[model samples]
Target chain A: MSVDPPVVHGHINGQVFSAAADATLLQVIRAAGLQVPTLCHLDGLTPVGACRLCLVAIEGHPKLEPACVTTVAEGMVVHTHTPELETYRRMAVELFFAEGNHVCAFCVANGSCELQDVAVEVGMDHSRFPYQYPQRHVDASHTQFSLDHHRCILCTRCVRVCDEIEGAHVWDVGYRGSACSIIAGLDQPWGEVAACTSCGKCVDVCPTGALFRKEDGTAEKHPHPERAAQLAEARHEHRWTNP
Target chain B: MATKPEPPAPHGLGDSLVERLHAVQQQHGYLPPEELQRLARAMARPLSEVMGVASFYHLFRLVPPGLHRCVVCRGTACFVRGSERLEASLRQRGVAFETASCVGACGQAPVLVLDGAVRSGDPGELPWL
Candidate 1:
């Protein structure tokens, strides 16, 4: 009848992870330094469980859970990585590859990207499925960064930037399911879209080559979680970002 | 007994460079110039060496993108908010490449993933996801 009290501590792979009652599963495991691949779950933004790649096995749970969304409960058991979970994650990456254009060899993100790293991690040697090949768009109207439709995975980092941060609300998603894509200014060319500020808030957040900066170092350095941990601790204590 | 240095190629892009790149990209992407320069510098070779790689590589972007980008907040918070609207916005507008996500403001509601921190027509900066 009532919700189960949040789990304060959980065991992931037999290792214990503890968090505040309010902490989400991602925070708990990430704090414990476990590697869980997530494309849509960002710390600042709200969790929507849009990307299911971070799914993990919860003991006694009926189905795999999204690590980014599930809140922690005491005495909970979580398995971030398992043989079956790996297969599931691999399939997710494969679908990502199949659904969009992810040519690593020719991508600006080539050596430095999460999707590429995940592909290697989940062992995506080849795509068994056919590419969806949706007619995505590329927007270079802005001077500093560009969006290449061929490489987009429809993750939505840019839309959030424009709406939540820029206060522009310039970016939005159109259509449904596989037909979905990132849009600009009521569905117009970004160059012509009045709402667009040319601020590439979305480019830096992209986990792949779909959105990138024209000026930043072409050789991207994927942000390390250890760095995030340090920053998170610092920020939690009000150190760096505040200064 | 080393040989004399060779002259740099046109536009610092070697011959096979562009051709090989086109083969890899196959009319999809372009190679960046700075990357080429870095390659050349790292090898202690002329800019052509790096440019050649840019031209030769299959996945490089030489010119700037001609399309608009939509970075959905891939961060924990925004991911939970349902970014389908923002993604749909960009696609409906008709960008060739579709929507990709990011934590424009992982700590904030929906921060745009940006190369520049703050510019006019640009979104203000937010913490990284």
Candidate 2:
């Protein structure tokens, strides 16, 4: 008595496949076993397409499109890996390092960082741009967490997850241009924020060592990015039954 | 029968972030951390996100301005007209100044805005130094 949803077909790197029209191209390509390097993207949060790492060449489109936000269409052809795209991705990753104080040696998320893994995946051996050693401050005022502006990539994953998923809206950016930074509760010390529930969700969603547990040392930080996806799914699935 | 009313926006966090920042900038000349955080709480957004928006525009100043602002134009025309010398002189005199890409006054090459007035010609004309 119900009609089947329309099936959309697309080609990723010349492999033909059919997918549900509602799913994003990223979802389909991921289902097809293709991996696209990303830093700002989390599974459950609304894809902000901020990092520009998941950009892929779509046929007939002059500019590259973000796979996470770009939906699949009939007869669509998406190329995830190409010389130009690889170069761009490498440059983007390198710029992220050059623009920030991403000292991997002393970072808490050194081993468990997506930025580190992506740099390795993209073959970014050394940065070409001059290092911008801007003097940034670290906020260790929180009882349970610490925020290091130096290690932050400005990916806004913590900001997004905190605002969109946790609904705390506790984090926001202050200033403009290259001097921009993350602030907690009206730029007050994290320990002073009355709004913070000590949820630790922001720390978990951060892609780098910028946000981490106070108890962690260098390379001791462990972030579970999948927790957001799991929580989103559980909330949706249990909403009706919980009542 | 009447239609249902739409839900109110969450935390006043809508598309007015830039406008709100401008309002704050107008009120204080620059966006300080405490004010930015206050706006974030009132708008129901994160302080980091608010800071991000505030810092994107060159017109927005996060730090306090000097008593007098000397903006040296770095446009192509002004570059050829020795705006560099003018800027250097200001620096030598320890006069606090900043540089802008273009001041939209290309006709007045080697132009510099002292205090608030845009003046053109030789750097020697600046007697304040």
Best by TM-score: 2
Off by over 4 Å in 2: A1-5, A239-243, B1-28, B31-50
Q: Which candidate has the highest lDDT of all?
A: 2
Count residue pairs with overlapping backbones in model 1.
104
| Fraction of the native A-B contacts that model 2 recovers | 0.55
Candidate 2 has an interface RMSD (Å) of 9.7
Question: Where does model 1 exceed 4 Å of error?
Answer: A1-7, A215-239, B1-129
DockQ of 2: 0.34
Best by DockQ: 2
Report the C-alpha lDDT of model 1 over A1-243, residue by residue, as the tens digit: 967655476688899777777666777788888888888766655466777888888888888878777777778898888999988888888998999877776678878787888888888888889987777678887666677878777667656545555556666665456656666543446666555666665665677887777654455534332333334456466665543
**Chain A TM-score per candidate?**
0.84, 0.94
Q: In model 2 chain A, which range of ten residues has the least summed lDDT?
A: A234-243
Report the C-alpha lDDT of model 2 over A1-243, residue by residue, as the tens digit: 967769999799999979977677788889999999998889878776789999999889888988878778888888999999999999999999999999889899989999999999999999999999989999999999999999998888887778777887778766656877877765679898877889999899899999999999999998988878877777776533222
